[model samples]
Target: MTAAATAATVAPVRSSAGGNAASLPAMRVAGLEFRNPVVLASGTAGFGMELEDVVDLDAVGGICTKAVSIAPRTGNPALRVSEFAGGMINAIGLANPGLEAVKRDYLPWLPAHHPGTRVFVNVVGNSVDDFATVVEAIDGMPGIDGFELNVSCPNVKAGGLEFGADLQALAALVSAARTRTTRPVFVKLSPTLGTGVTDAARVAVDAGATGLTLVNTMPGLVIDTQARRPKISFGSGGISGPAVLPIGLLATWRVSRALPGVPLIGLGGVSTGDDAIQYLMAGASLVGVGTAALRDPRAPERIARQMRRWAEREGVNDLTTLIGTLQWPS
Candidate 1:
């Protein structure tokens, strides 16, 4: 379908901002309601607990906890992160305490401390079954409103990137995950997929994915000229921050245009409200703040406030009207 047609047909379902107020920038996706469009992207904010002291976790719409696997992961070697001219790169390798620990320690904290903020567990795996395994285990877990499948992590040696590129594997993976949870399942896609991303989005949605997160950081390598070696310990890492903003926006536009009915959590290099607004105009139901939040823990709330201010100034009472309103040249 044409972008214009899709935009008209897909009407965003508005919901209350958790009864906080009628004017709050609230939105609902796949039955999960967000108080606003801004969300703390995974990996940057840890599990929302890490930022408790510095940030008001409930200020933003929601938080996507770091990738959780079936087993614990120490992650990549030393130089896991490095800075560059455009943005930052990191090879965190989905390092986390794993599923059981998440169940025992991580999930419980959100409800008690940040009751207003929504939570989506980012699930990773070394294989097809592993994805479902973790999701199934946490399906009934309280405080988790949904799941984001990390099938596009470039830093991993095994199943991460491989599952994203192969349509059959991607289909099977999403299908398996779909059966394990009744909550929303968002497939995080890779920006490096180029023109094929739309096809992948179709496959995922057909396999019963609830939505798509566009996208994960692109694979990159930063060289240390003085040291005559790669700066990142993993040699190559996933590049994030401002450098990936356009890449992610383009992916969101393509997928949103093609699958207008599918909900999208637009993430990449967002630091300010204008950046978040661009994602909304490009058709994202939600905007994720990662590198910016890492740089400043207060960024998520600030961005959300900025969005509200911008909306009020522009007289856009319902932020949902701004979604998928992108216009292409005739």
Candidate 2:
């Protein structure tokens, strides 16, 4: 079926931003309601607990925890991150304390500290079964709202991008994960995949993905001229921050247009409220703050405030009205 045909199968569901939009910042995705549309992107926010002292965790919509595997991960070697002109490059290799550790150590702290906030675990693995195993392990853990599959890591099994780039593999992975959990499933797509993102989105939704995370960082490389070696320990890393904003916006537009019914959590170079608004206009149900949060721990709270101000100024009583409202010229 064609993209349009497939999209028509489901109707667009607008989120309920509370009865009086002026008072609340709520949004819904796949029947799950969020306090707002601003979310802390996975990997950048640690487990959402690390920033408890720096910012109000309950101020934003939700938090996506760092990618976790069935077993603990040491992550990439030294020099895992490097800065450049427009953005930063990172090859963290999905480092985490593993599934059991997260549930035992981190999960208990969430409800005590930030009871109102929603938590989504970012699951990473090598094979399809690995993804399923991780999902099954954390399926009913308290304080966890959903799962966001990280299929774009560039330094892991199958080179990370392989699963996201291949339609069959992506479908199988999503399907396996779906069976293992009753909670919502979101597939994070790689920006480097180009047209393959559209195919992957379709297969993922059909296989049981509740929503989509529009992009992961694009692959990049930086060289240390004097040393004649890659700046990052890994030869290449994922490029993020303002440099990929346009790429992320375009990808969000394309995929959202192709899969209108699938909610999207958009991110990439989002540092301000204006940037978050752009993602909403492009069809994202929610916007994610990643690298920006690294620069300012309170970035998500600030962005949420800005979004509210922008909505009031534009006479947008309900912020949801701004979503997918972009007009195309004749």
> Can you write out model 1's per-residue Cα lDDT over 228-264, one digit (the tens) per residue?
9999888998999999999999999999998877789
Clashes of 1: 0
Candidate closest to the true structure, highest lDDT: 1
Best by TM-score: 1
* Residue-wise C-alpha lDDT for candidate 2, range 139-207, written one tens digit per residue: 877778889998764324455557887777888888899889878888999987787788888888888
Model 1 C-alpha RMSD vs. true structure (Å) is: 3.7
Q: All candidates' lDDT scores?
A: 0.84, 0.82
Candidate 2: give the clashing pairs: none
Which ranges of candidate 2 are over 4 A from the true structure? 1-24, 153-161
Q: Give the local distance difference test score of model 2.
A: 0.82
Taking all chains together, the TM-score of candidate 1 against the true structure is: 0.92
Model 1 steric clash pairs: none
